[model samples]
Target: EPEVTQTPSHQVTQMGQEVILRCVPISNHLYFYWYRQILGQKVEFLVSFYNNEISEKSEIFDDQFSVERPDGSNFTLKIRSTKLEDSAMYFCASGDTSGTSTDTQYFGPGTRLTVL
Candidate 1:
């Protein structure tokens, strides 16, 4: 079975630096998403991308953040400037949104971003 994959399993940076988290979802999946979990907080949806454009986004996804599918196989989330509050485990997920009761998303291992 295919699964989502992310790069830079762990990242350590100082405040105000830029970071790009990358992911590759299952080849046939049509929906891609980014979510994050602060150390002791719940996982929150950040954004969803489809058809090469943003389909939905949460309040957490502001001007400082952006996502792109640079090619057919790679999806990436870029933070223009990192903040201490941005430190968290970022997850990448994908699923087929075609009407199906069994629609389930497969998540990547996650990229842990730590800010100092």
Candidate 2:
């Protein structure tokens, strides 16, 4: 089975800098999600996108964050202003095109963002 792919496995940026994390989800998946794990903390959902629009977003997804599928094959997350607290392992995931809420989501290896 095809898996998700994330670029620049690790990124180090100054505080307040902007960063864009890229991912290529499964070719046929319909639901896409962006999640983050702050070191030892539990994974938290940032946002979900489907059909070229945002389906839902968590409070953590403030004005500083945005999600977009610029193309049919690429889904991306942009952090306009990175803070120390924004340092985390960001994951890109996609649900199988099963057309159900319970569809399993496959996660990418993740992009580690470090803010100094």
Candidate 3:
């Protein structure tokens, strides 16, 4: 079965630097989302994209963040300026939200971003 894949399972960066987390979402899926968990916190939604435009976004998606579908299969999240509080496990998910009750999101293993 197709699954979401993320690169550099773990990353450590200093504050003020930039980082780009990569993800390969499941093929044939339409709805893509980004979520993060800060250690013991709950999974917070960042953004959701479809048809090459943002469908919904949370307050967590601030000016420092951006997302792109650079190709047919690759999706990426870029943080222009990192902060210590930005440390978290970033997860990429994809699902088919075409009114199908069986459509559930499949998440990647996650990319742990550590900012110091």
Report every candidate's CA lDDT: 0.93, 0.95, 0.92
lDDT of 3 by residue, 1-41 (tens): 78899998999999999999999998888888899999998
Ranking by TM-score: 2, 1, 3
Over 4 Å off in model 1, which ranges?
A: 97-102
Count of backbone collisions in candidate 1: 0
Which tens-of-lDDT digit does each residue in 38-83 have in candidate 1? 9988999999888889988999999999999999999999999999
lDDT string, candidate 2, 1-115, tens digits:
7999998799999999999999999999989999999999999999999899999999999999998899889999999999999999999999988758788999999999999
Q: Count the backbone clashes (under 3 Å) in each candidate.
A: 0, 0, 0
Candidate number achieving the greatest TM-score relative to the actual structure: 2
Residue ranges of candidate 2 with Cα displaced over 4 Å:
none
Tell me how far candidate 3 lies from the true structure as C-alpha RMSD in angstroms: 1.6
* lDDT score, candidate 1: 0.93
Quote each prediction's TM-score. 0.94, 0.97, 0.94
Q: By the TM-score metric, which is better: model 2 or model 3?
A: 2
